[model samples]
Target: MAKDILHMTYENSLTFAQDLDRDDPLRHFRNKFHIPQLNDKDVIYFTGNSLGLQPKNTRVYIEEELEGWATLGVDGHFHSQKRPWFYYHKFSKEALAKIVGAKPSEVVSMNNLTVNLHLMMVSFYRPTSSRFKIMIEAGAFPSDQYAVESQIKFHGYNYEDALIEISPREGEYHLRTEDILSKIEENKDSLALVLFGGVQYYTGQLFDIGSITAAGHWAGAIVGFDLAHAAGNVPLNLHNDQVDFAAWCSYKYLNSGPGGVSGIFVHEKHGDAELPRFAGWWGHNESERFKMKKGFIPMSGADGWQLSNVNILSSAAHLAALEIYDEAGMEALRQKSIRLTGFMEYLLNGFNLGDDVLKIITPTDPAARGCQLSLLVSKNGKAIFEHLTRSGVVADWREPDVIRVAPVPLYNTFEDVYNFCEILKKVIF
Candidate 1:
């Protein structure tokens, strides 16, 4: 499948980029999104890692829910024919299950990512005096770090003692799989949970979730992931990997609007486990939910983790974006993502920007990354980023130095990548 990319020669020319686009089966998918404009022209958007562009169908989907609410009033909970608000959360189940490689019953579109992460920790992060420590990558997204630390403190352990952060060796930008496994083994006796981001946001490294899960399980720890930068950006097999739990926000690669609904996956083996969880009426058995009874009988599978009913307006936007994923499919999107990102890498390397000027910090291996490439600028990084912005290239700049760019597969094109590189080269050189 990758033979073409492995052997193909790349040219730094508009015609070559156009030729790649002309042959791309997923090229038309870009039309489904509304590209942002800059100075009367469409901007070259490469910040899907920060926030995904608005899908063209988002308004249509949101309006449907508005119309239902306008006409059906309170009865919309049950009588709205198309998608009753009462069962709104279920609408995203099948599509999300396929995206995350979980059974329909094992996945749920629910609260925001951090909320779901806290909820999952409530159930899985049980700590004892002997096995009370949590292990995480050193630089996980801030929200995950905050959530994990708070969970530790809430469990009556000082985070300084209970949180074990695995750092890359000196002079490294990404963690080696062996180093991660070794850390897990070294802390096996004290590790209570092993949590990591599906992709390291700063470095854009796609962790080996399957291998990490195996190692964590071997260490007698529950394994979970925060898939914020990963969910729709890369193909995932959470269930087959035996991941205990995972959560992801929809605003990034999922292409839902900002603060869109988040999804959670719980391995089916935990579907019926008598675990402790913060329960609400929505998570109770559906038939008995409105009975207003004293006892809380949780529903089966991931649905039991729900704390409240789905947010319909935001979820509608999610459905619209997910419709695209359902159509484009992860496997096809990933194939294009590899070639598109590889093409960008090829173009950047052609610039001969020495490490003293610009260096790509992301892993060079295609399998070790998604579409995002983190460029570490040696000097004047912010000025270069601002220059690209002025030139109508939308990219992300992390604090201090790194510039992150992601050419999303569902909407970005080879031409977009080529054009951005051309703009970037002009600014840097």
Candidate 2:
């Protein structure tokens, strides 16, 4: 599917990419985001997988909340002219559900990414003495590694014994699907939970969520994902996949701002009162929320996972970004995303640098990756990254030796990819 749409011989010329940009369906969205400027020109920003470009309307959305606060004060909780603070998170629910392909009843917005991971762990990481292992990818984002380790330790188990780190085979960059499935089968006896990043932060590999979830259930284990880098960047089917739970930050692909509010999904099957969870007033039944409740009765569905009242300011920023997503639609952006990332891969693969000069560590199969491509530039990685930075290419530099570039579908264009490759070519020399 990716090849048929984007594997044509892409010419390495400024005009070639500009021509593609002219025909791009989502090109107009580029102007909607505030691209960073260098020397009065917009820098070729390509780090949407980290912090996304802020939407132009973010200020207006935030100001609306601020204005409500100023004009209504305590009354803003219910009397705001626009959306009241009492239900601010609700504005983002539909959009997030659409983005992740979940029912509105199964989604809610709150907290930050790792915090939600911890909270979800508190509820779902039920490890008995007989079955107390957790499986995670070897190169998961450091925060997830820390969270999983701590969760194991908190349960009075040693990390080394309770954690199962899955890695790529020798002489391989990405983990094979068969290898992962086989490992799950081998350790099904002791594996109680499978927690992995929906998209590996370092290698940009998109794990097979549906297959992995089915495998975990078949093996009598619960499966969940931390989707910090995947939520808005790729198509998801959380509800249909029958995932036990999932959490993700909005700062990256959701364009909500630094430390933007996080969200989570809990399958409807777990909404029963019997499932033990870490409870808070916000998770209480809304009708009795102000009653200063004696016994904790959680709201049904994912709303039962909320820890506190929504952050009005951050959620306003999220609402602003989600409006754009609602208008753009995930299906349309996904089609463009496959094309944009495919074009970047096409150019990266086309780079004729010798093996030692550089190599891409991300999977070539588009189905197994997102918009990011991690370049393992041998020896001079930091030097090359600095050069790209000086040349007005905004990207992320991972420690050791990798440069991560993501040409976001909302704002980035083929010309951005072309310009980035041009600078990279010069840097390599």
Alpha-carbon TM-score of each model against the true structure: 0.99, 0.98
What are the clashing pairs of model 1? Answer: none
Q: What lDDT does model 1 reach?
A: 0.92
What lDDT does the true structure give each of the candidates?
0.92, 0.90
Q: Which candidate is the best by lDDT?
A: 1
Q: Which ranges of candidate 2 are over 4 A from the true structure?
A: 1-3, 6-9
The segments of candidate 1 whose C-alpha lies over 4 angstroms from its true place after superposition are none
Give per-residue lDDT, candidate 1, residue 161: 97
lDDT of 1 by residue, 1-429 (tens): 477754467888999999999999998888999999988999999999989999999999999889999998999999988889999988899899988899999999998989999999999999999999999999889988999989998989998999999888999899999999999999999999999999999999999999999999999999999999999988899999999999999999998988888999999999989999999889999998888999889999999999898799999999999999999999899888998899999999998969889899999988899999999998889999999999998999999899999999888888999999988888887
Worst lDDT 10-window in candidate 1: 1-10
lDDT, candidate 2, 258-364, per-residue tens: 99999999988886546778899999899999999599998998898887998899999999999999999987888788788877777777777766878889888
